[model samples]
Target: MHFISHLSAVLALAPLLSLASSAGLVERADDASCILTASGGDDGPIFVDAVQRCETVVIPAETTLSIATGMNMTGLNDRNIDLRGTVKFTDNMTYWINNGFYFEFQDQIAFWMLGGNNLRLFGGGAIDGSGQVWYDAFATNDTLLRPILFTVYQASNVVIEDIKMLNGPEWINFVNEGQNILYDRINISAVSTSVNPAKNTDGWDIYRSDNVVILNSNINNGDDCVSLKPNSTNIIASYLYCNGSHGISVGSLGQYAGVYDIVENFTSTNVHMYNAENGARIKAFAGPGVGAGIVKNVSFSYFTEGNVDDPLVIDQCYMTNATECAAYPSNVYIQDVVFTNFYGTSSGNEKSVVASLACSPDGRCSDISVSNIYLEPPATYGNATYTCQNVNITGNAAYLFGDCATT
Candidate 1:
């Protein structure tokens, strides 16, 4: 799908819709707030009926509430969650690993799963995941499945703003099987005190979601600032400041065989990236029986990075071994990707190449263009190189990493 000539037309076809100013309230039998009594034990029971019974449910700022059990807050409509207190989750690994809601796409699990329509949750309050224990534990036990802090599953018309999330066990937020969601003015941070470090602590992972907007977010984490997982479409991520993380990524898709993944109509703009591994990346699985997928109609523009490695990257052979990748190669296809107005200094960790598009053999990637790129290696690294395999890229070579090495 070549869109070079239709650049203006394609830009005008941005799939994201403007966020609705308001979701008109409906007259319900109970228009009052259900204020829950803070409990030391599981508070899941307190919210069991509040979401269904009242139009507003309040978690007041009086006390520090602890939820020691996994919660399933779903099937709500026209509800507003007014969270004004600090809600902390207990580090009961055994119970949570066994009971958290399972998501098959990424083999992920969630601690507190929330879903509903016309639902809004906004407060200046904080939610703590107590990740130190998980970090230390996962260092020893690789089998440990850390629960995602928050998951919006099977929801629509959701707006979550002005919330503070800290120290999640894994991904901070997961938009799974949801659409028309807006997340704005939110803060997310995951830092571990131990030597293990917080591994895979992504800021947000969107899967099977569409028409979503993530704006004005400040993220300090260890993984992708925002990742579009399989079946994600029509998304916009803007005005983000990310640090100590991987950049905005399209996918590490095609992991499961006999499944087709699609991530399209995505745009990321006005992002400031600092101290990350890569500024922008798209990774897909390789080798036989891995799976098949396509990523198209994507634009990553207006990015500035400092101390980032491989500021632009696309590796279709994500986890597969080198020899196997050469022989079997990835089944996923990538096309119509544009990287524009990017300026950065490479971290110089991998000094061999500052930008890589190592796609699989047999024409799996096409219609890739880059423009207005000004990425230079740090003074310590001397110079940088651009490498490509089995792909043709079009753009201004004088601005990019020189004429790319295509083989």
Candidate 2:
């Protein structure tokens, strides 16, 4: 089905879009107040048409719209989606594997993509990914391709708030090539019901986006709470409550060869982390045949952690092995980073080591600062240990690193 082309078309002049009003189907309404319900069939086309033709679309309370196909609802203008009910994707693994929208960066795909200008999607409803089947299938086969729940692609001046996202097969939200976006009061949770856990279900992954703000959210996922991927700048994430996550991170950049990745002017503050792997991290790839990048003017502050494994970290090697990392250092240059006001306890998974700032051997890292770090190891471990390599640190807490190597 084709989307409506002209925004100048009136409600009366719009073509008749078929929406089944059967047992659970939504009744037809005007273009200004279009409401949708499930038709027990593929409601994907109907939902797509409603967003294209209507000025505002509403999914009413107690309603659940079943979507069985991938949707590309991009290039819209001044649209609004009021989701007071639920929009659930059907668990048809075979169909989605063949039809989901592909993204080339990390070889990812999305279930639905919404983008445009002056768009607002706010309602106390949910967008469910029906991910139990995907979770169980991925347990045995690691090569399964799961789709992300929601993606904001090529949009500007958007506000997505007060929404509940559930059971994503992979990532919950992805903001790609967008600008001036704000996500507020968003609650995301992806938990597996069976033996296979919800893996790689990151709360949000921002890539090539600018002026993005994520505030006042609670995320419980398996991967990074919020990750700033390549070319993400001017980003701010604050007042976040992340549990069972991989922390708010920056990069695994410089992975793809010949590509230049950059993350700058990013700040994450007022965060509370619990039972996490790493708290504030910046990771980059290093080795032969990899890309290059720079990370500068970043800050992580006012964080309170509990039982975290590595509360603070900066690893330039990233996924590269230690032997390869020493032989071929990272091409990413890191400078002017600040880590301050951290108060918490480590899980003692590494015994006494609470933080590690391991940069490459070359002059790749400079002007890194640390202060007000009060993270303690378990009682059995005695004292917290901070380790560093090939970087000069300056701050009130610089003594913790204990004679960091100067390249």
Candidate 3:
């Protein structure tokens, strides 16, 4: 009790000091009286920036704004965020997840965001997501398909930089159907605990999007650190550091069916994976009468894996169907998959070989190649095996291919 009182007294007296002494629960505003500031009201006809308090603001084209939050930013409509000094959300909120986002509803603490566009952050600051409410709510609800950090749709040209997301809800950064998106110089970290320690918390999930670039980011999540899902195409990720999660994945494709399905032109290079599940995987379920999922022109190179589940898993015989246990040839076409300069460790029982390509008998995964691959497992498993009926391997692990000519 005395310590709490003393801390409160110090906080009360601390503001009398210089702004340099500012710390927690501190709020600052942009002042037009000192320098240049956006001029006007919130009628979509004004250029509002450099102010202290605003319920809703319309940032004019080619304008900049800096925001500090006591609660959160709600009702942020379409705006051009050309520049921002800094944006800080409350370390604690009434709810569990204090997401510093433009919510979908008009009320703060709501868990949805609708509009996004041309939002750029220059001068290196942060948009912190204190995902307390999201965490508490998801856990209580036991909702499987929950997203944590960001939820924006139908927006375009989103640029995020120099931010640190300490704890996320489910998926940290979800860029959907937006074009020319870049998440640069970002770090997302969440250490797993025994209870509720980050499950299915993928680092960056891009679905139905194009021309996305994720460069120089570090991720520690519970699921695929970087996942390129169905309808996500023409993507590139480089210089990524992943820890204690599923390394990086291409598909769990055909989850959302359509003629408009496929994730293409994807590349993951210069990656470092440690304490993770399968380093590189292409996962899909098996069923019948579903639309076809065709994946083509994907490449992975220069990666280091640490004891991943299956250094590489092509389980086309996914057990999504219980009754159809013998159901083979899930309509998705897995083709032109290549692995090169890949070095990694494997599982407890068998670590001999580094690649496992398990496909269906009828629609067996074909035209797959692995080159310059090296695996050193922990004495439990030895010499990774290639068991695809219609796949061809032509590298160091190729001589094990006794029936390479027939299929």
Candidate 4:
């Protein structure tokens, strides 16, 4: 009877032993380092435990940690995540829709959010969203809420560098209400292999953030390479190579009613745009019942482009009909904006129109200057054309935009 009891005890402990072995959780002699390998199951809980317990968490090479649930590793201090392997979120739409962390802006969700102080996530690994299913699903249902791949939410003094982000469902990296953040040497690509294209895959969207820097990055995506949303200030992006993007844009702002938006002190330079829709753009909403905003002290310089549709654009009457735009006009005021050192070839999509500065009818745009711009359309499209409306143009390239209309 004692022997039988011993065998039953061992049998009861078998599952625990299997779980510990599969988790591959190793504690080093220093006690500050934790190494995690893939458990081939739901690794989200294991990852969270390591991150909460250790100061330095390392995911070794050739390991792919699968996460089925959302991770919120926020409120951490002085953490280092050395990712030498891949961290892939599972393609379970129903699970994510119910379980992913939801954000109010744009009704978006996220699979993972990392917010902390003095945190560094690097080491040249990749974060895969497994976005093929989302891409195909979004093609059928446009209203489907797709989750962002990575988000820096309410964190300060963070650096995310030398990383590869693949196949994000929507925006890849979102810096929301963060300060002193730097994204350098990052590579992002989101392309669908199916008939349904990857849509709304912006490289980086900075909202309500200050003192952010994005440098030396390559983005091949569908939407804006870098966008400064409302209340974004003191932001700089440089040395970027963007392909199939919507340019380095500012302010698709003033969309919500009774809300005030502001994007100021933004600069983008040394950008090479290829096969894009716009090279440099600023878009704001118009018509009745919309919010008011201000875009101030913004500059775009040293941009080289090829096969772009509109190399330079400023559309104040965004998403509004011409009659409504002329009737209501945009409430947003644009001031102290400069575009310089632009050399590009337009795709001739607008025939001879290479640049269009269509501001609102009122004196809403001021101190606008353009200089050293040499853009040419295709040889078959005759000469390059620059169109302007309701704004006085100043600078060496001011003559490019013929006579300004006052009425």
* Candidate 2 local lDDT, 224-332, one digit each (tens): 9999999998999999999999999998899999899999999899999999998999999999999999999999999999999999999999998888998999999
lDDT of 4 at 398: 98
Of models 3 and 4, which has the larger TM-score? 4
Error of 4 at 41 (Å): 0.4
Residue 153: error of model 1 in Å? 0.6
Give the alpha-carbon lDDT of every model: 0.81, 0.89, 0.57, 0.88
Q: Model 4 — which ten-residue stretch has the worst lDDT?
A: 1-10
TM-score order, best first, reads 4, 2, 1, 3
Candidate 4: tens digits of C-alpha lDDT, residues 5-65: 0010101111111224346654433335667778879888889888887677777788899
> Where does the lowest 10-residue lDDT sum fall in candidate 2?
1-10
Cα lDDT of candidate 1 equals: 0.81
**Given candidate 4, what's the lDDT at residue 248?**
93
Residue 304, candidate 1: how far off, in angstroms? 0.9
TM-score of each: 0.89, 0.93, 0.71, 0.94
Two-way TM-score contest, 2 vs 3, winner: 2
Alpha-carbon RMSD, each predicted model: 8.5, 5.0, 11.0, 10.0
Clashing pairs in 1: none
- Which segments of candidate 1 are over 4 A away from where they belong? 1-31, 398-407
lDDT measured at residue 190 in model 4 versus the true structure, 0 to 100: 94
Can you give the lDDT of residue 228 in candidate 2?
93
For candidate 3, what is the total of clashing residue pairs? 17
Which sequence of candidate numbers ranks them by lDDT, best first?
Answer: 2, 4, 1, 3
User: What's the residue-level lDDT of 185 in candidate 3?
Assistant: 77
For 292-356, candidate 1 gives per-residue lDDT tens digits of 98999999999999989878989999988778888888888999999889887888888746788
